[model samples]
Target chain A: MPERPGQAMQKSANKRRATVADVARQAGVSVATVSRVLNAKAGDRNPVAEETCQRVRQAMQTLGYRPSQVGRTLRTQVAHVVALLIPDATNAFYAAIAHATETALRERGYAMILCNTSEDPAIQDEYLREMQAHNVAAIVLLGAVETAELRTAANSDTPIVFLNRRAPQGVPGPFIGIDNAAAGEAVGEHFAERGWARIGCIRGPQTSPASRERFEGFQSALAAAGKPLDPDLVEQGALTIESGDAAMARLLAGGHRPDAVFCGNDLMAYGAHRRLADQGLSVADVALFGFDDNPLNAWLATWLSTVHVPHSQFGRAAAEVIVELANHRGERMERQILLPFHLEVRASA
Target chain B: MPERPGQAMQKSANKRRATVADVARQAGVSVATVSRVLNAKAGDRNPVAEETCQRVRQAMQTLGYRPSQVGRTLRTQVAHVVALLIPDATNAFYAAIAHATETALRERGYAMILCNTSEDPAIQDEYLREMQAHNVAAIVLLGAVETAELRTAANSDTPIVFLNRRAPQGVPGPFIGIDNAAAGEAVGEHFAERGWARIGCIRGPQTSPASRERFEGFQSALAAAGKPLDPDLVEQGALTIESGDAAMARLLAGGHRPDAVFCGNDLMAYGAHRRLADQGLSVADVALFGFDDNPLNAWLATWLSTVHVPHSQFGRAAAEVIVELANHRGERMERQILLPFHLEVRASA
Candidate 1:
């Protein structure tokens, strides 16, 4: 909307920083004219009036108007935007990662367009195309849902960074994930030390690479310790609290009850713990472990031992990689970024 | 990056959607030429080879290429992007709102740029100016922090929607908020139904208008019931679990023993519940209430009674209003939107 007579007075009354529009108003020029001067370049062919340019610059100085990188982004066509695709933001794990990524990108004067894909490959594909069409700087896929659309996006002109999940089968891209196998092995070893003879596990969705890797590495460690994981003790379900509760209920109804159980994520662990509590059992009787040590572990659900995936580190690294790739500054180094994880042994385990 | 040799072969191997660049390649024309043809106006004066336009159109048909709105955004200088300013996305309240807002905007072919300011006015200012310079379709401030920058942005050209908080000071803008004061009164009356004589309250940050409104409404209800709120029983703290815990601890240590307590949000109630549990007391003994009924109520923290604030409604309304205002359809009507709330009576109360 065009500014009215008293709008400038209202703006000044509110302490709004001067914008190009403000500069344009003072210089008696158009907003586009002001932008042209702000984004003036060497060897530029377009001829702008010298007097007009000086007036715009003088107006900027008088108003303390610091031009934003937006003009440059328009000149380049590609927006300073990174579309972050996460399965669900309601999950604290994704929320933390999104927060970190937003912080990192904002520091570089970039904006993050967050998408909640709901673990559906179709949703993921839709967002992927829209982001590409908008000429976003990059796309960060968190726990990417493997689809044919993703396979093509992997090799598109825009760069993609995968978190927790590796590149969709065979395509090469900048991938960021943790040493989940090692973390799982460590958890297995810690469980063995706790003297729990009958250990069970509640795995997340089988589609998730992280969940599969965690379970596989766990079995490897158990086998090495002369105690192969009992096949009857494992139950697979979605990564939700309800699924975890049902899985735990099934585990209890089975013939051989496990003394300790590990879940795919914290939500699953909470469900498992709640089920046990309802059954007049406690973490003291059946130890539990979960993944993704949410920041609120200490305040709520402190008993469930969990693995701390450095969400901030994941976000920062993803943002750094995206920015570099978007600017064409990264083409060789650090294609596969592997972060570390640690087990938080709480009272539950 | 330009498509390398055989990159098309790889792209074909995958199911990637064809972009404008692909159209340019198939037609053997410059990318700019393809864009010009895609964006041809009713009276385009630039003379171009009719054969070239036909070839470009044929390439688009062969590739099943659907031109995106990006070209229109470029021509108009206003991308279909909305800036959502949130205090923190990690909180389930804000996270839910963000998710809903994202969904609504996505349906409208717009993207949301989430900004987590952590209640800092300075950071909010930086993001405001940046969004303005980028010419975002609108700015949605969730629990807006009162700042001069905010006051100015309230009157800026770009549409601004205030949620949870009204416009800074006296500035006029569209707002989406629940009837918090009425919700508080409902909670107060409900507490009286539970036959709790000694009732206490824990408030959120003093800067938040919602918190103040909620408290004032609660006091009004209590006074009507001939049990005016006791100042000694009230504790003001931040909207954090730790703050909630500290406030509960202080209430417990006070001279009066309250049988029921109301908190600003569910997190605070969780903290209070945990504190009571730590002291070997259950909600059955000391009733508790909270606000913003998180979706995880039944699965986790089932005992903490709360008020159900319609976060999805807030997001949807904000999105609808912003879209209307940004597109210049909303000059008046429904400017101050007030959503509804309900009392969720859990075992805690």
Candidate 2:
């Protein structure tokens, strides 16, 4: 009988510690039988005769034996684990996605192991290798897979689903995310409708599919509207607050300042908002539009107009895809899941 | 040589693909040598000499031969992994911590496995067990250990360092975090000096040490000011925007609203800000204070007054401690480190 912490403390206080022998005696079973039952391994050993198993179980319950998970994991090959690789966990957008994904994973009896790649292709490969070594059942990649190395590694045996990212053509896997290109087009139309002609865009990293697709859609929309897309007005940044701040600062320093600014993500928009405010310009004064309708944007203080990615659904769908793949054992069709994105108009832009 | 995707596209436009042997033949290497190098096992075999190693490396680099991580993990016992378990990754505060921690861990040649526990003790325990099963070197637990089960499980052989959460007395390990009690006292003193008559506080989850310490410190400072602390004024919430909103709503509904509100964390403050705003109340109208000076709070839109928990330092220190423990396998040190916290007063409070 393994004494639980609560019972141990109580017994120590009362000087009535119960031993494994005592439990065995009470159950009319051998110490080994009692031990096996407490460890949840009775199912593996000769079915334990139902009456005896019942007695052993009752003994463990009365003795308050808390089975050690450490011991159990060592015996079981299935760790009930999965791995999630993302650009950064601290970004609220990614974090929200991770949080939702974790919740869904846990409900499905899977534990998630997370990796922060920081958009570095090398680091991403390293984490991928590590996750593989852990025998993670599946992987959910939340950022762009830049190098061919990552794609090839993922293609072999791992049931990978992309979250907030898209696999290139010929990559056999499911990608669960919003249509970045369409979202960008919507942003451009929103700006054009608002009569903001001279728009400056702070794009995300060029390597990311999201950044490229969004840029393509925005450019297409601007071209359709007969607006010349100024290459000078466009600047690339990593999807980060600091990067956004730096890009916005550089844009401000440049001689030509556009009336409206479209940021790749909401965090970047917030950064642009800060820079504008520091320059004695408020959000209302210099219209700012951002991608990812983060919950913070809805707050009165930051009322950031943005595009809303179905973050929770993206996560749920990704998990479902992975679970489906796991159950079918690689027999399911390769899915390209593109959830919808909403344009949320607020006070900022 | 493995044909480049571009060249392949140009050649066939639509073909299934060449095999690994074909790539080896093109690269001018034996099939076995190519297999060893592509599998990331060049160092293990003597069959491929140094010159051959370089040639294969260059060929794979040019040919873009990415080995499957799943196959490698199945063969090797070394996962080269560690887990960074956080309460909420989307919360900028936790996200920043996780990013820094991952960076530190990666630099040490360990892959970071991220787990968003959502402050759920059960989920936290499940993740911890999973990490152990995967043979992770160590675990860095961020935020609060919300369950007694997790607290006990943390005390096992698996090395764990609690980030931003204080362990119970005599836990026999170091807990790296800022002094929440002192931070709360600082907020109390700030409110006292500002001459706020009635002070309200939004505490975090009851299970968290941060909430208890902050509550204690706030109570002490208010007691020193001879201001009768109203039990009804304190509201409990999960460290989230929604929880903060709901708690504030409860506070207002209870009709025990104070002149100023001190939040356990920034997200909650942001949430409370939203509720107050929706109710047509300005932050300036009712003073607000928050903890964890997250990057978002520093934004011009937020400008929230907060207690700055050295975000990077928290992650760095925790990583340093775990790395130290891992290096000295036989040595044991029960250390308790308390980092400093600073108060940042902005336009909001």
Candidate 3:
């Protein structure tokens, strides 16, 4: 898509096009070194030695190796582009992470390309293949819908890092996220102190391992507090406002009148709050709790209580690990990197 | 960085490597046809005739061709990656547009790559160069900080589309955005209907043309209503809550007791609202207005009256224009496209 001169295709006497590896061999340097020189600028922090850069240029001229016509990306290790695959970017939680990750990647001398998968397995698989074909240096998965495809796609050629989401069992790449069970336990304890008798759960999709873990921790905490989460009170669906509203309706339609509700995420909590408000009920009548302290909570959802995941910390850690893996090829870092989470007490719960 | 078999690099007797173009020549078809065959799956909607695809495969097999050994991105017109450059994704306004654009692009057989510039000229310039190097099929710009650089970067090779922001003068690209001045007039008219006196303005940075245009429209409408916007009541800074709050403080500290204030964006209005609340005042005491009815506005900022720029419409329009440009290379389409805007009168103004 970038411009190349007409002379690049005009061959003299139809000679074979020289490759970047050929130039590397002639310059007596590694392919990576040549690639770094080609991609980096004069005052770049990478700082390829001027003398060696001159040698590479001289070697290129002698071999008539025009970088434009040589298919440079095919033979080079410096793609310099990282792909971040998330389920949805419209969510404030994911947007915060994406913003932080983009900032961190820019600081790490790499560009991030964000792809939204909308929690569709086919879409995620297609994006995985597309990233491979595009020669991205690395990938960061926030929440993937297809684990087996991701497992098969993980290789030394293109490293993958899971952020704020657990990777599949035995996935080779590093997984960087907060401990969901601990965070959920914290939320449950905070809600438990209120002494609510009937605590209902509006969880995310059943396929999400994080949701199940959080549900388990909440149940255990509630049981320890002598107010267990009722099995008939839990509803699972998409982690969206519409789903939360539907689930809240279902919970209220039944004979059991829950005094408090725990939502999978803050958006769902917002939905549940609005749903209650529509029925001439305030949050004080039925407390609401949630996870993922969205960035807009202070301005918008001031009354809802939720858990705050340090979004920037998780993004920075994920980017740092991916960069490390990219710089040191064929290397594995920590298998699981955990960050801290916070529970914020607000008016709703 | 995708995995390639070891045998791809272990050359057999040092023979010359074949190229995709070479295979196309051998198969008696265009290079694009061969690339389509190579990248498409068995059930793709881009129905390449099975007979032609078979001939291309036969040609490749006869020539000992391995796609992993070739730079498939180069020498082909099917990059299929449309890059959307926005100021920030954390802003719910931009995130809404991004979500809509991604859905449209996926439906059109393209993947959208989102890059956040944070309104930094240097970062935007660097991302422009990076996108070119990565061979993105097209680029869509929203609130670009550096216009001259973007004008120079636009070309037929990778078509550019200006989205929700006007293009630089003489730039060769389709500018698809709402009429900012008209939207400002609508806001001003709505505010005028309230019969407020001594209206103040918390404007965005002076460098933004849209902000200037909006101010002009607002001033004109205020004048038409016989209540002029005082120059002493205006303060300009970053379009963020901090700036808006500081601007409001400056307005009050300067002895300008304004009954209403206009913020350049919704988040700024939220700031102004909070600033008033801190002083034991309310929106009814000093009405506040804003633009960009963010997705979370209904849930979070229920009282802030604002202009609603249809984010999904803008996103869908931009994506459609870019896909058309990418499919029809070297063809100049419409120079400017305008979408509609609406003024949402909420409790704040």
Report, in order, each candidate's fnat: 0.30, 0.22, 0.22
lDDT of each: 0.81, 0.72, 0.76
lDDT winner: 1
DockQ metric for all predictions: 0.28, 0.16, 0.17
> Quick one: ranking by lDDT, best first?
1, 3, 2
Q: Model 3: per-residue lDDT, tens digit, B1-349? A: 2111321111112234456788999999998898888788777887789899999999999986655411645656345677888999988888999888888887786766678887788878767766665567788888866556676576435567788766665666677777777787777777788788788999877778778778888888888888878899988857888888888888878875789888988878877777887888898789988988888787778777898888888877877677666656655554566777788888877
- Tens-digit lDDT track of model 1 for A146-186: 78888777666667888878775686677787877888888
Model 3, range A235-268, lDDT digits (tens) per residue?
8857788888888888889878789999999888
Question: Tens digits of per-residue lDDT for model 2 on A116-193?
Answer: 777788877777765654446787888756678676655655566777777766765567788789889988877777
Q: For residues B20-80, what per-residue lDDT tens digits would candidate 1 score against the true structure?
A: 8999999999988998887787788895579999999999999978665456564565668
Error of 3 at B173 (Å): 4.5
Cα deviation at B211, candidate 2, in Å, is: 2.7
Candidate with more favorable, higher lDDT: 1 or 2: 1
- When sorted by TM-score, best at the front, the candidate numbers are 1, 3, 2
Model 2 chain A, TM-score vs. native: 0.76
